[model samples]
Target: MKESHKDIWLKRKQLGRSRYLVLFGLLPWGLGLTVITSLIELISFQQINPVWVPARLVLFFFIGFFVANARWQAMENRFESDSQQRP
Candidate 1:
């Protein structure tokens, strides 16, 4: 069964959970990027750079946060543009 966008948005808006969900939703993307970058470095150098892994994670964490926030804002706009609830 396919869930409608309104239902998904309602879930996100409920209990103000969207605040955290929006940001955390980017976790998989950030982690995948981090792992890919780290692996590239590992393959090139033939050794793991301990410092870079944590550094990339921290950097991407912040970056992902901002990106997620922007995405959440965009989502709000998208919903507002066409599917706003009636008062």
Candidate 2:
């Protein structure tokens, strides 16, 4: 049996969502959060704490990851609705 158009469109939309999550959300957020937190300590104290820095970095990275996921979900919902409305 052949696949349907709706199925294909849905698959594409899912892929877009995943890509957005990884590229637009998770990666930059993780990198930015880490850098920002690290810089905060560095600038405030003029020196980085070896232990606390890595911990803070990981925490910030996860925070960014969740924010990205939320953004991607909203985009995905919009795309699905838009596709459904078209002929």
Candidate 3:
């Protein structure tokens, strides 16, 4: 089916919102993970291990996926509500 202009615009808006969420949200989350992981390693292992770098990358990827998904859902919900309100 051919898509309307409004639909195209909405999709672009949603994409932009998701990108914004993923890019901005990942920084603080990764930083917090690094700090907590470092603290744990320091207390338990008495030194920060090199393994943390890879582990952090994997964890950050998964967490970023979920966070972006959540933000997309929220944007979708808001878009639906706003569309419904339009005459």
Candidate 4:
């Protein structure tokens, strides 16, 4: 028998032991943007170029946190809907 969506979500939540998945997703995306900008600066050889590493870090944190919260919310919603649907 096929597993319910709720069961799948529960397993995904419980098995998501490491909190690093959020970082893994956020860092590559943010860092990719940062690196591209930084490279453009290097290629142009601009004096006193500003890449804003701090701002990139903030973006990374925000994205990571948002992703984590979204995952949790999705899981909770799935569980609640499943419970409501059950007889």
Candidate 5:
């Protein structure tokens, strides 16, 4: 535990600051993915289990959401840094 590990404090980890999450931009993307994927699944449901259908919908949406969000976050940070560097 960090509390007990006195040595840990001596050699403090040089971890980078955590990401600054901007929910305003990311929320729409996440919800959009959820809605779009769910609509696609609406076309058919013969193969997938009824219970798993919602689960799959949720999974696909979240995967798309997180992946897109991460990429978007990186791009946002890059653009910000680029803008700051411009004279």
Candidate 6:
């Protein structure tokens, strides 16, 4: 059976929300892992570069932002398509 525009839109919206939630939830875990890795390096080597943490954080932030933006764009496209299909 073919799905209606409304149904497609709802599904897309749900997917977009889930992607955003996943991104938000994983961000902290990523940061934690970075910190743990940094600590391990520091402990093992007795000298760790201090610039890695900020660079890692900035990279994480930009990646997350890009993912979130992509999901948002998908949701927006679905919304527009749904609206166009309406009478």
Choose the strongest candidate by TM-score: 1
lDDT of 4 by residue, 33-70 (tens): 56766677677876425557668666866776677667
Q: Which run of 10 residues does model 6 get worst, by summed lDDT?
A: 21-30
Tens digits of lDDT, candidate 3, 1-60: 124745864766765865666564566566567677778889997988887777886687
Q: Which stretches of candidate 2 lie over 4 Å from their true place?
A: 1-19
Order the numbered candidates by TM-score, best leading. Answer: 1, 2, 3, 4, 6, 5
Among all windows of ten consecutive residues in candidate 5, which has the lowest summed lDDT?
13-22
lDDT of 4 at 77: 76
Error at 33, model 4, angstroms: 5.0
- Can you give the lDDT of residue 50 in candidate 6? 83
Work out the TM-score per prediction: 0.68, 0.66, 0.58, 0.51, 0.43, 0.47
Candidate 6 local accuracy as lDDT?
0.66
- Can you write out model 5's per-residue Cα lDDT over 1-81, one digit (the tens) per residue? 233342442232222112212232234545665565566666575243467556655676566557655755665565566
- Please, what are the lDDT tens digits per residue for candidate 6 over residues 21-75? 4555347545755677789988998977988888766676666666666756776
Q: Would you list the clashing residue pairs of candidate 4?
A: none
Q: What RMSD, rounded to one decimal, does every model reach?
A: 3.7, 7.0, 7.5, 4.6, 12.6, 6.1
| Steric clash count of candidate 1 | 0
lDDT per residue (tens digit) for residues 1-87 in model 2: 123755654665667766756666566877776777778989999987889866766776677668877765665676677767777
- In model 6, the runs with Cα more than 4 Å from the true position are 1-49
Predicted structure 5: lDDT: 0.49
User: In model 3, which residue pairs have backbone atoms overlapping below 3 Å?
Assistant: none
Q: Which pairs, if any, clash in model 2?
A: none
Off by more than 4 A, model 4: 1-8, 15-51
